[model samples]
Target: MDAVLSRLKGLTADELREEIIKANLKCGPITATTRAIFERKLARTLVENAGLTEPDSSGGNSAWLDSSGSVVPPCATSATQDSVTGEDGDFGYGMGLNPPEEEALSGTVCPCNVENSQSETQTPSKTAQGSPTFFYGVCPLWEDVLARNERAHVYTDKKEALQAVKMMKGARFKAFSNREDAEKFAKGIFFSVKFPKLDHPSMMEADTINREKANSFKSPRTQDLTAKLRKAVEKGDEMSFTELVWSNPRYLIGSGDNPTVVQEGCRYNVMHVAAKENQPGIVQILLDTLENPDFMRLMYPDDQESMLQKRIRYIVDLYLNTPDKAGFETPLHFACKFGCPEVVNILCSHPDIDKNCKNKYNQKPSEVICERMKEKGQFQEVKQKINEYLEDRLYIPLLRATDNSSQPVIGAPWSPEPMENLSPRLPRSPKDPVMAVRAFAGPLSPSKADEFRRVWKTPPRERADHFHNILKSDPDRGAERVGRDLAHELGHPWAEYWDFLDSFVDLQSSEGLKVLEEYLSKKDFRDRAHEEAGENETSNRFKTPSPVRLYDCLQKRGIFFSS
Candidate 1:
């Protein structure tokens, strides 16, 4: 049971799900969402199913009484067992057992069969308090033997067993608590080997020795170098810092004796310190020196070239993006907060920089700049530059796709001009042509329409209130036509909802314009529209809106708007 539980723990979530399905266990979606849940549920099911199959005559006793009358098992039984058998000439000698006992441990008879035979001949008292049992055998594949001879080796120490396992040619041996697990694992492989559990006291002593050896590697000289390196960063002396780092690159590895300075509970590394001090040169020097191949070799002299290169990349990334201990703010966050545009620009252009990394407060570096602007009434220029940088990072590909060479078709079905003297005239009410004229003339002036277009181009947060002011002033204006015209101009999909405009206007009057503004200005809604239009499909194919779908959504939200 312990072996099976251990094996299940090693499986990934997807692999565990596969195992559950193969076992024909009933599992729901929620159970399959996490690896820990899947393991627990599956382990419970296995234990329960194991309990159900132990009563058959062919099935041997799942457990036996130990010397203390506690339940143990022969042949290392799991939670359940079907049978146990050993063939003649297939058995090997047990460790520390006499030659006379070898016959009793012969392969021709099953260990459980011997127990059953002994039970029938011996009294209950003798069988209940039997001597301690030991198992010994070699698997059919002799090529997997660790020791040259067929003799089984006993391991009372954990370190020796681990070393033995590591020394095996194919590392084919698996250590389990008992023999039944060995048999179960053997079914999937051509060979199997097992090692006994190590004594607890020896393991603890070995751990202590290893810890002592590791501590011995850190000398007074290394501590002095670390102190000097940090001092150079504090003084903003780039040449001294560079010399210290290049002399022994290990000085840059960790926080060492004098850990990074903490301000307001936030621990700052050398990069953070440099950025906060507005020393762009020091930051640049650190960046260049940290990634140098020669410095990397000096730091990790024992590693292979491939492994050394990978470690160097990881170290460089950690230096760039490691968050402060308290706020989880990266060095880039410090640069923005200190209003150092030069440092910010240097960090932003680096290929490995994580521009979108959020702090514990869920604010990105640009957001930090915005918050600073609000407090100090400064950094407005810095805020604008950061926003521009973010926008370029996010939308450059979209801009490249929509560049002037492959221009989008922009005219919708309706004309942008006034509807007074058109040849194909708009629909009019037969009872009141004057009323129809007023409705078709539209309420917004040309400048107001232009303002609406400009509002859409701004950020989403800025659009809502501006839209509310524009649409609230004249609720019955031909706002729908203006929206369609603006959509055509910008190659957006809002124009596709033209037929539902009356429903939207009714919704605005009933629920207030804020609801309408939120619906149209939602980032998710715009993204969905773009996805539905196919990212590359930039033409203005203004389809009519489905009134039923629009009404259904409104009704679900407990809103009724007259059309």
Candidate 2:
């Protein structure tokens, strides 16, 4: 018993596990036992099996004790013989003896002898066939290894063999075309194993060439899952949607070319699909699932937020407010445009919802609802609900006193310069108030604002005339159109501000003209506006801010601002 224990201790963890499996010993699942545990279990199984066997001719206690007084386990002889013959070896083929016989013969053998004998016996047959078969073998052991199987594996195809080795839990693999090489590898004598040159060179060369390009292609399983998810979302099948998304949270997080939720052409995520289909339940489920701690960890495993609840909140907010690629519209935008008021209300209730988010057209959810109401002659109630929600949540005081305080000026006072002298020459403005406002207001400097105020010093009726001319020349003939153009020109920093001005002040009315003039005349407003614009400028000469930068800035600001 002591000698048998000593022999078991000399074997590696993998060898111990292989012996245990051959002995048909139940050590629970393969993943449950550690190396020390495997040694103990195999040692106990061997002692018990030896007791059941009859004594040898020398009248030793059992067949385990030989005449030389050395311990030889019952199964060791047959295992050693199989290693040499290369027959009935367990190379993940399950070709070994049945459990009852296997238990009676289970024992440990040196890996080098096992590998060399098998290779010696098998190599001749392989060579005679001239098929150039490359035998790939792997034995998975312990939780550290990543193999799919708990036993050894042998493959003829190099690619299949390499893949199996990678999937092994222990991450250990050996591939060799030479018998001596295989023996060295099995004994852990070498770090690298080399394969023989095959007739078809492209098989090895193609993997290296296409490795990078292959990264951009989604796996077939992921593609299939995405297809099924889309179908469930489109059909408003909440049960199927939850089952698919919840079971595979990693897919929902999206990475590289495998966006779990989005469609191929339009790039609309599942949120957009649900909202467009008026699936309020699906939207609610998505929100709830995103808040799951386990799911959030998968989405943001390295989140800087240490608190689990806070990290989940951050992830949920991102998914809730994320916009689609095609229209730059959030799910809320789609809800207002195509879904019911219930869907809009549900979205609005989210703590981090961006009610003032704008799409590529610079239209907000309320504005989108209004357009839908006009075009389809429906969603009037939805529009009213969204407007009411915005008024309550995003209300900006209309009666706040405007400060006339002055700010310190930098550089020389503004002076008219030739368009050619400007680094990025300003957009040429035609001789019209509306086009001039569109072009000049974008590059509004403190000096330019003062010039506009001076020009507008005429009587209220005259100011009304200028405003009326702007209205007449406007192609859309809408106050909102002028506001949108100005907002688009100003870019994202003050888009919501311009929208606010357009919504509250009726540019078509004379009274609204008085309010606009008063607001523009404020010294503080001009200074702050110029300062903000200057901060965004890269050069002294004015140029339109980039749309991409504008979008990034707006996203950073969470797409909401107070006027």
Model 2 alpha-carbon drift over 4 Å, by segment: 1-222, 256-259, 297-311, 370-378, 393-563
Cα-lDDT of candidate 1: 0.49
The model with the greatest TM-score is 1
**Residue 82 displacement in candidate 1 (angstroms):** 24
How big is the positional error of residue 563 in model 2, measured in Å on the Cα after superposition? 53
Q: What do the candidate models score in CA lDDT, each in turn?
A: 0.49, 0.49
Clashes of each: 1, 10
Model 1 poorest 10 in a row by lDDT: 393-402
